[model samples]
Target chain A: MTETRISRRFAECAAAGRPALVTFVTAGDPDLETSFEILKALPKAGADVVELGMPFSDPMADGPAIQAAGQRALHGGQTLAKTLDMVRRFREIDAATPIVLMGYYNPIYVFGSERFVVAAKAAGVDGLIIVDLPPEADDELCLPALAAGLNFIRLATPTTDDARLPAVLANTSGFVYYVSITGITGSATPNATRVAEAVGRIKRHTALPVAVGFGVRDAATAAAIGRDADGVVVGSALVAAIAASLDADGRATAKTVPAVAALVGDLASGVRTARVGAR
Target chain B: MNTTPNSLRNGPDDRGFFGIYGGRFVAETLMPLILELEQAYEDARNDPSFKAELANLSTHYAGRPSALYYAERLTEWCREKTGGKFGAEIWFKREELNHTGSHKINNCLGQILLARRMGKTRIIAETGAGQHGVASATVSARFGLPCMVYMGAVDVERQKPNVFRMKLLGAEVTPVTSGAGTLKDAMNEALRDWVTNVENTYYLIGTAAGPHPYPAMVRDFQSVIGTETKEQFFAAKGRLPDAIVACIGGGSNAIGLFHPFLDDPSVAICGVEAGGHGIDVENGHAASMTGGRPGVLHGNRTYLLQDGDGQILEGHSISAGLDYPGVGPEHSWLRDTGRVTYVPATDKEALDAFQICSRLEGIIPALEPSHALAQVLKMAPTMDKSKSIVMCLSGRGDKDVFSVAGHLGETM
Candidate 1:
């Protein structure tokens, strides 16, 4: 059987004795050019998968951190098309890295879901993490992405019990995005062992890989979870880092990229250490 | 019940547009937030846990299953009104019993929860009749969230009870001065609030108009009405009603009543618009359905009550609720599709219903819904005696009594 591109990408990362490092960046944050630079810098700094957040006003699950980043991005003239153009540009330099466009579905649906998926695939997005789209609501996004050969990454939180796991797993095309806690993005404390238990539980359902996110702030937390999980997603923390640059001074500054990239590198190293059994 | 459970949404690439009506028409600044709202709404709407939460709030907090009442007295009232020939049976699915005493609570509760889910702490909304504002403020109080209600200065004076109600509900009432000081102006003010406070605030639109997902999504949230009514009627009479009638302000409540009845070809759906006075457009009626042409008013391009040059015309109604310059995009779609019929009731007729309901049924109805009741009085009498009609009493008449007193020359 021909393994899907996401499965192939996961296999490559797994075979390298390293966990995949997924970084989340609000598109056009601070400025579009600066955001492009930040995206360009991630792969070199050891991010295997990059998640570009489409800035939106009402991000339901986002904490104060991501919310502020979204404000900045929106203020910076980031749009659905602009974010896609950003990806289309980033793909030119970084083709090997799996780019996961993770955000809300409204923009994509607004852009015409079929056109969005085809364009996203053409621009080099491997998967989609539409935070809450599942089987019942899958027709608008998930099914279309599956047909377009883009992985619809499903999120499984603590709320996802035995009754829900099978359906969630079924809706997923790429590696499952397991939300570690029940709360919003920045509210949870990192529970890697619990995440590992979740990953173990999920493994029984499918051969598909699992990534643990939400409150995986620092390297220690990331490694603890990445030690057992296939991929690690750092979103609100990076957003918090970016938000620090805004400060009392309204204009966004450069500390945004380094603050997040340095943490990403550190976490990437931790995951590598765990893979080599150095931990 | 071979329940395939067809969701109310159209297919993807469908744009949620029933036809050429619903589309996202917003400023560049609001583009992201609107999209986010669309996405979050889709997700939470689909998520079982989220649905359970909304359902819990609906059943427990919103006091759902707000009695499908058989108006036995009103049925005989129709019998006498129609010369005792073709008498009719009327059942009102009383949405007025919901929290805040209006069907607007249903939409406000759902949207407020969506805002909360998205970590939005502040809610801003525009109100004309103040039913939606009162509903929004109530939900804001219930959720412990800060809320802002924008009302046209004209509406401010007319709907004083509602303005006072909003203030008591812990919401800041911003009186809008622009554009005839009415619903459009209030909407402009609310949009300004959204643009300024886009980060922490969620603009809870009062009606089933505006951008793509909103018109459809709001209808979806409010669709629990038709869904409940269909079931309740089935339990009561073992069948669907011959007609579903509701008044249209921005057409939210009417859409709620009409959406479930869309697939039922046999069930006639009628929407009553406020015909303020006079016979035509120059008379200052808020009959968006009748006086409106295909034009943009609020967000989505739809049938708008406009002047000769395509400028949206000012609207007037005794009921501040019905005094709107435009209808929801989906309502325009429904109008064109002929799936649902849009009718007009003058302010005098609405007031007449207000008096009749209070006199006959001992139920004083909100002015917004009085139009529907008035229309029911007009049309139900013309229908077969055995034919059942369901009127969506969107709210109680408590808010309108004082306002109506001034009109009827009663000093109390």
Candidate 2:
């Protein structure tokens, strides 16, 4: 197992005195070729870490935007193998950016968990964020991924009180994804004051970097969360940008890559400018 | 006090797993809520007041101890129709006589009580055939909790009477139009709503499905049907019946009747699923145990109708309640362990049994239990006269009258 790229990426962002900007894209939105092109374009567009979504038939935790993106990806014949292939392709050009594959766990379970983990490491994937696998069931994928040198990120929500935080963070590695809101992604914006408090509480427990996501649709919201978190994750909003850039027939337009890149660039600027005075 | 038979009751271990099936396969956002629910259900299970109040409601409000009547005429009709090779006695565990006209109310009452204890202010549920929706709406109205029921648009059209019944019970019915407009889609929408409103809402799942605590809790509530049948059968015949049968939609009613008899080695248990057109077609039948493979869906690992790509396929059934791609995870466990036998009842078979039972026994059963009766009608004629079978008539047929009329090409 190779060393994870996530920890180094966060350390690099810390040295640069800025919160890392993390972007999310479905692996095969519209089609495989266009999706890989968008993936390659994300780094130059200022994304520090890229979270690629492996589309599943049912993404229960997602909002309408990501759900639609996944539906498009699935309609275009995206599978776990294809998602890994896209990662293999993205690693060819840029080996520095940490790539986290995020989705539900059924596909991996169907694809055989051990086989998927080995394949993911070989494909240059850095981390995993399976939304449905809680810490109580960590041995299902988390431990295996950790053994394979991939960070298995766990999500802590507002409902996660002090009594449950320890278990939630027991085996979590590389980073802790603090879901900024109680609802699905893109549904409601998080209160930065509450998020700061949650972040402070979580930092007291683990030394892992904490990234905030959910309901972060624009640069302004990203900046607000970036003030207190180690990283700012913008997922549904970027997926929505890709959706908006699609042609009338739902195919990728010429502006698809540019549209996603422009949003990531703005978000990157927001994260970079946050917490200058305090830090 | 752990009324389950010692042999087959030790499932779901500590983590709510029944063998390889039945775990909390929900989103991380719902983990806290699920843990809270698990604790709350445990506390309520131990509280005497909770049991007392639930019992009082069962006896006076929901009409518990639904009759176990000998279907003498139906038994005779079967014997005559099947050439008298077998003259097995048939009995009907009359869950249809319950206040909401189904076994669904049993689980609803128990869940609403748990919801009240947990301090939840609102309730939400998903319905397929609308029996569970009506039952849930009835309890919400009784407990003064604002209720919302998600029903597939297709089911709302086919089960209009139940839709009207739910509305009359003061529940707001939201028609879900996604993913073939069926039970599975309705559940997906309900889960979405639950994940969105996790603070003040209690998702009152109507079946023995979903994540942990649900399959077990719903079975505990519905086990009243089996418990009552056990007592009544012993009182009537001085012994337990040779076999018990029930239909498996999400398998709530079937598990209700089967769980109590699971330890009795001499008592055979069979679950009948709706085989819509046939089991061979790509999109036909809700016979997950017979025609499907084990997979994860709606927060539990169960036998589901899916394709090679792991995409869940829609199931077809004449009964809206049984038209789901997945069975309850516990049923999958039971099937694999060989504790229970699961079979399929085709549309034509259930329809003919529906008409025959109505004519012979003067009871119009819901289409769900008609599937069970279809299987019983076939199996009863093959058994000796000394042997007996009890079928759970899970619901009344009033709500299904319109659909039956349409299917039979008769005008209302």
Specify the highest-TM-score model's number. Answer: 2
The number of residue pairs in model 1 that clash at the backbone is 4
Best by DockQ: 2
Per-candidate Cα lDDT values, in order, are 0.79, 0.91
- Write model 1 residue lDDT over B1-412, tens digit each, in one string: 1223553234223454556666655433355567678899889987898888889999998899888988888788888876889766888989999988999988988898899999998989999889999999999998899998999999899888899999999999999765578888788667656755667889899899876678877888898998999999999999889988999988888888888777788899899998889447494788877877775444565777754433356778888888877888878877887778888898899988899888888888898888999888888788898899999999998988888998999998
Clash tally, candidates in order: 4, 1
User: Can you list the residue pairs that collide in candidate 1?
Assistant: A57-B33, A60-B118, B87-B385, B129-B321
* Docking quality band of candidate 2, CAPRI definitions: medium
Instruction: Name model 2 segments beyond 4 Å from true.
Output: A1-3, A277-279, B1-6
DockQ of each two-chain model: 0.02, 0.60
Tens digit per residue, CA lDDT, model 1, A44-159: 88888888888754454565677667768776778877888888898787667778887764456456778889988887788888753444456667889888888888777665
* Model 2 CA lDDT for position B57: 94
The residue-by-residue lDDT of candidate 2 on B235-268, one tens digit each, is 9999999999999989999999998888889999
Candidate 1: segments with Cα more than 4 A from true spot: A1-279, B1-14, B281-283
